[model samples]
Target: MNGPHDMGGMHGMGPIPIEADESVFHSQWEAKVFAMSFATFCNYFPVDETRHASERMPPGDYLTSSYYERWLYALELLITEHNLVTPEEIEQRIAKLSQEEY
Candidate 1:
């Protein structure tokens, strides 16, 4: 259970900056990710499952990823684990979206 995600009492991580009047989400995509995660939580996965999935992410990746990125990783992991979607399908979708952005 000890991982980069479990930095509860660790030190030398730097100070947490407090931003006044910070929005719940810094971007539209973050809000969308939250909405997606929430919906999946209610219907397919429990909150703890998602939390654990996020924790299971590669330590290097977990350390560098943003909060919402971690959530996305969890969602993808759970969905794939349950066979709701395949990894190749997810990769294809990402490729499609990437092409559309051009």
Candidate 2:
């Protein structure tokens, strides 16, 4: 069984296998992060009234990337917008991580 902060188990679903290297997050925390990021991204672009209400629309090319990629992009945007992380620091961290093998 997982603790309060463990997100290994599927939400309202059966248990999900936990990989040895994956970082476990609190389900609530993940939900909050997702909501925040999704809302922020939605606000980034103007809505298209012409599009059908039920039809799903994709974000711009940049946001259409993978889930983690979109998260990283949103994080970068938030970091810069809030002045939490400097551009130089982001570049340095990216370079360092790129050199490391998974």
Candidate 3:
């Protein structure tokens, strides 16, 4: 799918920083996202569906978002597309979680 996600063999993107001892996850949420995505893939959606959803993201947003952020977007897209949850439900849940954070 020749999208922005296909960055292979590109030039002038700058060198990838090699960390001496980087952890598998940079933060807790990344691990959570990964787990959530994995669970969904196991039970609900195919892996290719998630990949296509992520590739369907707007080019600017796709390029700017972090890896887990993209995964979250794709998850949301697939779930909403399949009527597992409405966008309103997702927003309501986010609001509930935000309130819990305070």
lDDT of 1 by residue, 1-102 (tens): 899988999999999878899889998889999998999989999888888999999999998898999999999999999999999999999999899989
Q: Which model, 1 or 3, shows the larger TM-score?
A: 1
RMSD of each: 1.1, 12.9, 1.2
Candidate 3's residue-wise lDDT over 1-102, tens digit each? 888899999888889778889887889989998998889877999888888999999999998898899999999999899999999999999999999989
Clashing residue pairs, candidate 1? none
Task: Estimate, for each residue in 8-84, the C-alpha lDDT of model 2 and write its tens digit.
Answer: 54377456466787654445546655676557547653333212211222335332444444454555655565676
- Model 1: residues >4 Å from true position, as ranges? none
Maximum-TM-score candidate: 1
Which model is ahead, 1 or 3, in terms of lDDT? Answer: 1
When 2 and 3 are scored with lDDT, the better candidate is 3
Name the weakest run of 10 consecutive residues (lDDT summed) in model 1. Answer: 41-50
Question: What lDDT score goes with residue 54 in model 2?
Answer: 11
lDDT per model vs. reference: 0.93, 0.50, 0.91
How far does residue 91 in candidate 2 sit from its true spot (Å)?
A: 0.7
Ranked by TM-score, the better of candidates 2 and 3 is 3
